[model samples]
Target: MTDVFFYHLQSRPLEAALPQLLEKCLERGWRCAVQSGAPERIEALDQLLWTYDEAAFLPHGTDRQPDPARQPILLTTAESNQNGAAVRFLIDGAAIPDPSAYTRVIHLFDGNDSEALERAREAWRAARAGGHEVAYWQQGADGRWVRR
Candidate 1:
């Protein structure tokens, strides 16, 4: 099954959910990845995941970049239009790298409009309809990751 995560960026800190989510993905032998524009949060997540899972945190891209020998999960930070690669991978419905390649796609958004959220949900559903497993998570009021 393709696992997906959606983290909502709100007034609360959404970064807090990364480590635990990564750990869960690792325990299940699922390839995991995270994308965010928040540098500090991404860095913190990386540190925690690596500290606990030791090589479970990986960095990913659309191009051919080898996974760090140390980590199996991919961590990507959005910059300029660079974040489009991640979005393209999802929107174009191309295959992502493993375990990320396996289908569990997580999308993080800054929650404000329900219509936007609905569109995202639909996109995710399309991915699933194409025969991929998917899941979602978002920043809760308390700043923790919660399923949508």
Candidate 2:
């Protein structure tokens, strides 16, 4: 069973939190696929990952690239895991119809959005019942992530 992580964002927005997680994924030599509920959010996330930091960089792209497998981070609105990513991030209420293909699934939901929070709750229950290892992470007062 795939390891499922639920990140409850209490302070920073997804824009500020995701890159940090992606950076950690890179450090662990794991490729990542970030999925959004809409194509517009995927496109926006693509640009944000590129320019979020002036000095740092996260090499990533969508299917529009020449080679998807070469991307350390792949962003998309679809549920396909074509990039061979070891980690899959479901952002902005995105859901994976088939998650067995992934080693891990990260669910990052906005705490302010009641619908998103509810969706996350349902997902956690379903995944846990499916015998997957589940964990919940929340941003601490110092803006650091503490798995709760």
What is candidate 1's lDDT per residue for 76-116, written digit by digit as tens? Answer: 55322232222211211122333233445655554675754
Q: Tell me each candidate's TM-score.
A: 0.47, 0.95
**Global local distance difference test of model 2:** 0.90
Cα lDDT of model 2 by residue, 1-148, tens digit: 8999999998899999999999999989999999887888888888898899998889999866688778889998778887899999999888998677788899999988999999999999989888898999999878899988
Once model 1 is optimally superposed onto the true structure by TM-score, how far is the C-alpha of residue 146 displaced, in angstroms? 5.6
Best by TM-score: 2
Q: List the residue pairs that clash in candidate 2.
A: none
